[model samples]
Target chain A: MERNNDVWVFIEQHNGKASDVSFELLSKGRKLAETLSGSLKSVVIGHNIESLAKETFRFGAVEAYTIDDQSLANYRTMPYSRIVNQLVDAHKPGIFLFGATIVGRDLAPRAASHSKSGLTADCTDLQISDVKYLRVDYKNLLLQIRPAFGGNIIATIISPDVQTQMATVREGVMRLEPLEKPGIGKITKIPYLPEAFDSIVEIIEQHRQENKVNLKSAPIIVAGGYGVGTKENFRFVEELAHAIGGEVAGSRAAVDAGFVTPDRQVGQTGVTVRPKLYIAVGISGAIQHRAGMQESNKIIAINSDADAPIFGVAHYGVVGDASQILPLFINVFKQKLK
Target chain B: MAINSIVMVKQVPDTANISGQVMKEDGTVNRALLPAIFNHEDRVALELALQVQDTYSGKVTVITMGPPRASDVLRECLYMGADEAYLISDRKFAGADTLATSYVLSEAIRKIGRYDIIFSGRQAIDGDTAQVGPQTAEKLHIPQVTYTEEVLHIQDGKIRIKRKIEGGYEIVESGMPVLVTVLKDAVSPRPYKARRVMTYKNAKTLMELEKLVEGNSLLYIDQLKDEYLSKNLYIRTFTMDDLMLEAERCGVAGSPTKVHKVESVVLGGGQREMFHATKAGIGELIDKLMVDHIFG
Candidate 1:
């Protein structure tokens, strides 16, 4: 084991509540810590966030660093960056992982800059390489896999020179570690100085829209793609989602068409979801779209073309018009519920 | 008086495409095998910045951080109506992520001297980190507006911009010397002007013309660099030495992030059993979901 041995995962939180991605990172971080002969640690930053830290221990973190300050409540780039920066410098960790959420997207880069570390964003896969001591061979490297080329290909990247390897994994890509035992993690409170925090940019107000759906945590997701045809056809997907008591998701194509918001998008450019049941309607299943939802427990694809790429990874493939098939499925489910 | 804007652009490898053999197992992307071109969203961002330059009666300078091959985007920038183009290319800047990248770019921006605005795409498709703009802004200690979809109006040293939010959008107002990260919908970058392409075709980075001049000759590399600098044509290539950046604080040595593992997940849908419409069956279905921890 190295002298400064700790595996730290940034437990991303919003509005004093922890994001599910934090648990996912903890799941993966636990394995990485074991491989490197280190202990798992988590950094939680927010106001009144001790409860979130308690949850971190249930998911494999042995020690949790909590920076609970009023200024740290809502995520502003500078303050959050400063806090994470302070922690990394104080406790040198072998690896720092974050969920590539909106807050993570804003904070990770700045933290990496402050720490002078390399960061790979939106990675789908992460692994440590076992390399022999110096002799010029392929054995010594940490391979980081991410979708590239607009999601057409998966690139395995390695950092052979850096000590602490950092990456931002997409939300829902990894399953959350079960909370079998009560949390046995110790919490350390970092001193905060409100006077030191000064942000040139202020998040004036966060407007919560009426139709806001937490797609990241949705259990049942019915997603649409380009094959959903025109913008009007997307309604069928929404109907299906409503029938199944789930939220509506869209491929990058549907989001680009303005049919749905980027938050509801399911793909490399959008949110990664691991719902209990994912019904991909009229989606041809580009690797980019699949990168986001391929982790779902069950994938049911409805496309007119049987040879559509979506069917390749789908657990159940129905070759028919989504406009027609969705309504049928919705009616059947409704009748069954009745 | 209007403000001058300089946008730093780069031509990254189309990293989205990754076959096991894309790197030839040699760690370098096979250019012939893989396609190389200007970054798509960066081009659009350049266009948005150029539009501001045209409206405000100022010059737009395009800068890129890459090898001599990156000169292509520089030329393309010139054709797109940029007043000047610079390429910051050096061996030390290779394999840089957003952190190291911002360091090199900030140095080049400093060398270029004065500018009111810095424009960059929200993120490059290749590395979707979206960190460079904010990081550069942080290093420069300037205000930054990210995910900007439209530049509403600029007047009296105050810049009004519309930035994309989660559900909708928000209008933000900032003073001059602000770094704006542009979204794809901001403005469509214009096509290259044919005349400028013809005139600036001879523009060359020191490394580009090094082959003809040889390792040593009447034209010293430093002197040529000076000539370019004097002509305002120098790309302001900076090494770790120029930035006074400690070698340990740059490149892979400086980066502490690592990948733990990689696995491809294949989602499979579960069994679907048609349920009877009776009251007992309806109650049972709801109970099953609750028991499974999927719903309650």
Candidate 2:
């Protein structure tokens, strides 16, 4: 077995709590590590983040490497990336994963560039496999699969020549499955060396908005599209969502058409969603939209056009005007739940 | 110091607004059906650069790396009030991953020196990698603030920027020469000035001039390039040798990652159960969903 076989997931934390995407990566990393017959490890670098490292065990990480310092409280690109670069240089990890968040996007590319490593952004799937290219065999390569070209094509990418393969997966793409019994992983504390240059870009202020919608955690979503037609017409989607006790969402077209806000947009450009039930109303089911919601457990698409693409992934298809059908949907749901 | 800004832009396929003819029935994209335009976010970045030019005493120079046809975007940049444009094009530079592309860009930026700030879109729509800007910053050993929504102020060689975070936003301050990747909604880009458009419409890259001089014994490529440069109608075009880039480190060879496979995503049809538009059918579907605990 090669020494550089361990898979490392970077644990991201917010307000001292670990991000769910980090846990999701840990779960996904377990399968890749098992495929490679190697241990799963996680790295956490933040102030008072030892608890996050401890939390990694529940997600199947075997080792948790940590670097803690007061200066590392906020995610400054320079310091965070340098610390990651230090870890990469010292450990020579075979595969490193980061959540494709604001911090992750800022850090991963810099670290990957500095290490002269390959990094794929916004990967939806990852697997470990043997590969051959130019008549040369490479063992246990990380296959990073992502929807590129505006989600029209799914490309499987590999960094077979690089030492450490890196990928940044967005939140909710992978399933979060915690172990039945949490096994305590060995926690290794790494020293954080302070440098003056790391403070070149200083964060002057940060403001959080409370009303940020999290469609990722939504169990049921009723999404409208351009066919919902107008702001007046989009209430059909909202009424149905309220009746079903589900969140409201829309296609990129609907958002552009002012039927819904951009935060609730579901597509390649927007956030991916995997709900228990995804009811798409008046949506044509563009591939970009499908890239985000096709993974839902059950999808119901309603469109006036019977041939709408959204029906391709839906379990139930209704050919009808959203205005006509959504009232009926809301009425049935209200009666059932009442 | 007045900020001299270099904004990285690209001519990208209009992937977001793709139509039926653009996507063939076989699930592969029909190249001829795609129309290349200045990437939306990159144009916003250029608008920010032009705003920097407006407020401060500096010129905004735009750069892109693509085919000779990519010179089309450079012309658009000129029309939109860019003081200068550069096209880093070479046949060998094809199939470059983000890292390799950034390496060549960093080298080009070094050649076109004397810039206090660099700007680029957070991510291009085609690849959607968002890696090149930060990667170029790393290669150039510069600080970077990405996902920038607004540039609040620039004074005393320090720039303040408001950038989008996960839940909300944060403001950060950085010194000169920091790379800022602009978000799409950062600013509304201004339309092309009719006067500038008419003036710069004749602007051609060295490759384009070479094509113009093709099969013409009367006109020489060097002479045409010289005339165009003197008249400010030439977009500075560079080959690998022009920037002293190593052959192996400029393109596919330098890329650590490779495309192992490309599967055209074909969402299969014919599995779904169809229902009539009637209220009865709607109730029946809802009943099924509740019974399956999908919406219970």
Candidate 3:
């Protein structure tokens, strides 16, 4: 066995709570580690994050290496990156994975840069494969698969020469496996060293947006496209969403046309969603738009155009104007639910 | 100090019209089949740089690394109000993943010298890795703000930027020499000025002039380059030698990530059940969705 054969997942936490993606990474990391016949470890770095490290056992990690410090509480890229870089130098793990969250995107590149390693961003799939490049045979190389060319082509990338294969997977791409029996994992506390130049950028104020709708985790999503017309017309989308107890989302066109907020946008440039039910209203079903929600279990598309592209991935389609169709849906749900 | 901005742009094959033969076996794109255009997000990045330059009275230099045809985007950048444009093209630079590409770009930026801010698109439509800007910043040992939507203010060597997060936007202030990756919707790219287009249409890179002189022996390379330089129509060109980049660290050789496979996904409509826009049709959809446990 190689000396550094451990798979490590960076556990990201927000507001002192571990992110679901961290658990998802543990579930995924366990499989990769098992394939390599190595132990699955997780690195949790933050203030008062020992509890979160203990929680890693439930997901599947065998060892939780922690660097808890007050300065690490809020994510400042420099300090967080320095800790991860030092951790890599100490442990020399073969594979490192991070959640493709804002913090991950910011910190992974910095760490990869510091380590002089390669990092793949926003990976959708990870697997173990034997890859040969030139004269060297890379055994059990981590295959990182992601969509390229605007989600038209899935490109599998592998870091053949780098010691640490780093990748960041988007939220909800991997499933979180909660075992019936909690596994026992060792928690190793790493002392934090106060480093100079910890942070260059200072956060004056940080707050969440008012009424932030988490469309990614929403079970049911009612999305409107540009065909919905005006910003006021989006009220029909909201009414229908409220009627069915679902979140209101929009296509890129709808967001760009001022009919919806940027956060409500659902597409390649926006957010990827895999809800249980996705009802696309007035969407033309462009490939960029479908890339996000095609994974939904059930898709129902309503559009005035009978041959709109949205019907391609949808299980059910209605040939009607969303303005008229959405109101009808709202009325029926209002009467049926009551 | 007035902002001296450099905008990194890429000429990406138009992804909207892709068909089956989109990717080569090695995972670099099959660029011949599709038409190329200035990447939409990079155009916005250039527009943001131009806006900052306009406000602060500085210079906006655009740089791109691609094939000879990539000079097209450099010309467009000039027509769109860039004070200068550089095309870093060489055969050894092909098949470069984000890592190698960022290395070469960082080297070029270092050679380009004075610059206060660097602007780049969040990601290219071709690779969509979104790693180059951040990676370049790391290589240059500077700070970077990705998914930036607005530049709130720049003063006293500190720049305040509003960047997009998952659910909201965050305003961050960083010192000068920071890299910003702009979003496509950050701002509407201004149209090329008709007069600037005519004036810069004759702009030619060194390689381009070499080709021109080779084709027409009537004109000498030295005199033609001198005339173009006098007219401010000669786009700056850099090769690997010009940047003093190591041959092994500039292209495919420097790229650590190797392509394993390329799969093209085509969304199909075989399972779609069409409805007739009637009252019964709406009711049927709800019932079917409920039965499938998608709704209850």
The best candidate in terms of TM-score: 2
Instruction: Candidate 2: list runs displaced more than 4 Å.
Output: A1-3, A210-212, A267-269, A332-338, B24-26, B268-270, B293-296
True contacts kept of each: 0.21, 0.86, 0.62
DockQ of all candidate complexes:
0.21, 0.72, 0.46
Candidate 1: residue A1 Cα off by (Å): 10
Evaluated at residue B9, the lDDT of candidate 2 is 95
Compute the lDDT for candidate 3: 0.84
Runs in model 3 lying further than 4 Å from the true structure = A1-3, A131-138, A226-236, A252-258, A267-274, A282-291, A303-313, A319-338, B16-30, B165-171, B185-191, B266-274, B290-296
Docking class of 1: incorrect
How does candidate 1 score on lDDT? 0.73
- For every candidate, the chain B TM-score is 0.79, 0.95, 0.88
On lDDT, the candidate that comes out on top is: 2
lDDT of 3 by residue, A1-338 (tens): 25367999999986678887889999999899989999999899888987889899888898999888887887776677778888999888989999887778878877777675768887877999887756677789999987766555677888877878899987767788976787889999999887566666656556575546688889999999988888888899998888888999999788878888877778755678988999999888765688678889888998888877788899888888888888887776655556
On lDDT, the stronger of 1 and 3 is 3
Compared to the true structure, candidate 3 yields what TM-score? 0.88
Give each model's whole-structure lDDT: 0.73, 0.89, 0.84
Name the DockQ score for candidate 1: 0.21
Task: Please give the TM-score of chain B in predicted model 3.
Answer: 0.88
In candidate 1, what are the lDDT values of residues B108-146, reduced to their tens digit?
788788998899888886667788987787677676778
Interface alpha-carbon RMSD, every candidate: 7.2, 2.0, 3.8
